[model samples]
Target: MSLFNGTIQALEHSLGYSSAKNRAISSNLANLDTPNYKAKDVTFKNYLAHEFSRPIQAKTTNSRHIGFQGDTQPAGYKTIINQASSYQHNGNNVDVDKEMADLAENQIYYQALVDRISGKFGSLQTALKGGR
Candidate 1:
């Protein structure tokens, strides 16, 4: 009876993660020249692992609710800052090459998720249309 089931919910969350990564990458790139601006990023492996390990389903009764609540999302996003290493003389840590790579990778990830969701909807449409 639910419109967004587990797989669909997972895809939605994946898209969210990809978007957050994109924003983080942009922020890092934007501060590339700022002195002492440490680069920040949302890690994928750990975040996905944590997301899959939890089985709780969070519900939002109001539009004012912010971010995923309870154990379902476990902080929703964990932004990691690069502090162990610095490559610039001004104490900034933004790695342009890595950020570019991450941006491209995140774009691909977002595209893949969108493709999957589209496929799911296509199947649903076919079913609704009484296709054999």
Candidate 2:
């Protein structure tokens, strides 16, 4: 068992996930008019898996499950592509409004994660300094 806990790890993964989503949204926005450009998306599950090394939907069937420390939820993250079927005249599937909304949401999520991680570190630092 570690001294800190899983909270920091979880927050770090969330930050990474949000950053990835931001990048994906930026890419979609940049290639809005590009022909046949399918918008790529990173699901929340994907980063959850990357963070915890567990599949997001994996159920405990047998005894040899990963991270089977009595935890029930499995873990994994899957990247979805080609979600947009009906494209515009240029065959682009990027939805500007949707992508913008996702971008803003992701930014908020990232900031929250950062703040939590910062607080956790601050607490640890204070502890190290003899609670001064």
> Which segments of model 2 are wrong by more than 4 Å?
46-74
Q: Write the per-residue lDDT of candidate 2 for residues 9-69, one digit (tens) a residue.
A: 6666667667778888989999998888989898885444444764344446677876434
- Model 1 is weakest, by summed lDDT over 10 consecutive residues, at 67-76
lDDT of 1 by residue, 1-132 (tens): 377466797787778888988989999999999999999988767766686786566666778976454555444566788888788999998889998999998999899999999999998898999985
User: Residue 8 lDDT in model 2?
Assistant: 68
The runs of at least 3 residues in candidate 1 whose Cα sits more than 4 Å from the true structure, single-residue gaps closed, are 1-5, 45-47, 51-75
The residue pairs found clashing in candidate 2 are 46-77, 54-75, 54-76, 55-74, 55-75, 55-76, 56-75, 56-76
lDDT of 1 at 107: 94
Local accuracy by lDDT, each model: 0.82, 0.74
TM-score attained by model 2: 0.75
Measured by lDDT, the strongest candidate is 1
